[model samples]
Target: MNATNAPDTVFETQRPRLFALAYRLLGSRSEAEDVVQDAWLRWHQTDRAAVRDPEAWLVTATTRLGIDRLRAVRSERIAYPGPWLPEPLTVDESPGPEHRSELAEQVSIAFLAVLERLGPEERAAFLLKEAFDYDYDQIAELLDRTEANCRQMVHRARERLQSGRPRFEVEPARHRELLERFMHAAQRGDRGAITGLLDANARLVSDGGGKARAVIRPLLGGERIARLYWAVARRNGYSDWRMGTLNGEPAVLGYTDGVLTSATVAVSDGEHILELLTLRNPDKLPIPH
Candidate 1:
């Protein structure tokens, strides 16, 4: 292996895993890319011969970078006008340690919501252990903490996560069907039908970023959320919805007369949706094809 080519080859090989680690930590593609780039710069400058564990070195670099970036952003988010949702990442499949279907589930809008609530260290510790399957010892070394401390952090993250996460998983086909039912009722403003399709504890969170007409806080309960849906359809006359995939899950790419205005994803527990996420922030929404 030549001097220059070796580093590029090594960085490229681990890029996806590094990016995944950053993305899950920061929850922003742009920021994650920046973090990965920073890791590359450091890797390129480091003494490669002395680094016995390239992946370990890269993982540590990427994760610590993520935690730093996350801490900086957490302050910015405090000033954000309303509740902030992670930028919806579209992934057909993530090439990482987790199983494809399971990974997809973990990246769902709802799951990310739970992760967003966690502190930076807690998030790092949890994702390393749960999603990436890093052993506690490895995680402790990565985070510069003791193994027992990392284990405790992961346990607390799990407890906090479980309280807000969905209880069951739905297959892709069933997920699509649920989105269809949601679209049908939402378009027609059928409160009763919407109620039947929503869990008793269903919650709706809209992110307009203060640039669009959206609720600034979470709307809780099935009946109340159904009413809000009715109000939206009535005002916008959006009786039609286009089916699409967001983050590899069935989602509603809502349109007003063929003009894309909103994108929505739901997290369901087999029987009904447990949480719904609507993104109306144009800047936050994905670019059109």
Candidate 2:
């Protein structure tokens, strides 16, 4: 590559990691892309030769940008219609080998929902330390806080996320199997069969953004969730459905005349689903190829 293009090559390599960090922080692919594009602009204008660690510089820039974006969008999310959900992303969208352990579960829609409880700084600190496996000192630098402060932020974030987290991890195969079973049962309008695959405390949350048809409030309890899906079936809603992966988990995508309609992601504990997130908002259904 020519000298003029060296910076572009370098920035492109770090793009995936940067986008992943941004997505985790903002929970919106479009917002993450905006942050990444901004990062690229800054990187291009920086003194590349003087920069010792390009990755570190880009990561820090991306994290700070993500934190800022999260803070800015907080109020908008609060005023959003119904329950707001993290924008669903395709599994192949930005999967990078550099992500820390349990990347899939960390990026799952359910986990992102739990993260909504954390403040912007706490979310950044916790994700940098836990999800991305950065050192406390590094997290502190990234968030412009002291190491001790960063630790406390991570601690608080962890405590808040713990209560809403799934009790146990489920293998991908088992997760997919359970989702398939649930889909079949829901299609058949077999309320009993559907409830049997859900935990007693199972909850269903959908985001229609007030522009589509969806439950205005969260539906709690296995029986209630099963009944809702059964009703949808009776209305011929699940007539055309396909299994796919979204937010690193098994998901069912509903379509009409080959147009994507709804995408439902299931969070299971090996045997039963603990939470179900369905995105019926047409504005949020774009799957990255």
Candidate 3:
């Protein structure tokens, strides 16, 4: 196809994949949409004839833009009001089942929370290599680093990921069961039952952004975590919290006056809850109820 006609066709063919890549890397649907729009503008202004592989070119463009924005945003993150979770996506259009599943896995609360620990370059390198399956050479080109350096970044990121969690998948049904029990125990002020559902070293992290009451530091251990939940429930009283899937994983949504005020996603091992992440910052609740 000629340069004039090729850009339009190429854009339509590649937009979805590019958006997916950007969203997984950045962990915000709105930011990902912005990145895609910026990529399209850059593509439109480029001399298409000079590009041999349009898809590869677009991918490189999008990744670089996302990386740049992430670097600029990282400094501001330290000053962010509360536990900064990635913005939740509210899918208006129905994508196919496979696409939906893939998006969920990539943008899950657990996955995005982990990504926050990496440096911007490391995140870009790892996302490009792991999620996109880009080779060392391609990744090197994307990050403007040597192939050896790119490989090392990916290696470090993989090691961190493996060392952090068990390889167990918490089924949705079982997750719901555990969450219900945990919530019931908290509401009833039954500390024993609440602690029973938690791992010995369970952690509770709350991101109320300093606006609502949340533990600034992660509360560790089953006893401590259970006590914290009970205290919060007692102090605030249980709003009408509904159980639902946040990113295809079990979650609890706290609502007041029919508006979702906050939501919690629990990461569990087979027997106990490992982590409880509550997203109460109004900024992070952009996901539609």
The C-alpha RMSD of each candidate to the native structure, in angstroms, is 3.5, 3.6, 3.4
Better of 1 and 2 by lDDT: 2
lDDT, candidate 2, residue 132? 89
Top of the candidates by lDDT: 2
Candidate 3 local lDDT, residue 11:
95
In candidate 2, what residue range of length 10 has the lowest lDDT sum?
A: 92-101
In model 1, what are the clashing residue pairs, if there are any?
none
Each prediction's whole-model lDDT (CA): 0.82, 0.85, 0.78
lDDT of 1 by residue, 1-289 (tens): 8876988998999999999889889877788999999999999889899999999999999999999999999988788878888876662222222223555666766677679889999999999998899999899999999999998999999999988875665676776678778888999888889999998889899988889878899999998999988887788674556677666666778665666667788888777987898888777666544
Position 255, candidate 2: lDDT: 74
What order do candidates take by TM-score, descending? 1, 2, 3
Off by over 4 Å in 1: 91-103, 256-259
- Which portions of model 2 miss their true places by more than 4 Å? 91-103
* Per-prediction TM-score to the true structure, in the order listed: 0.90, 0.90, 0.88
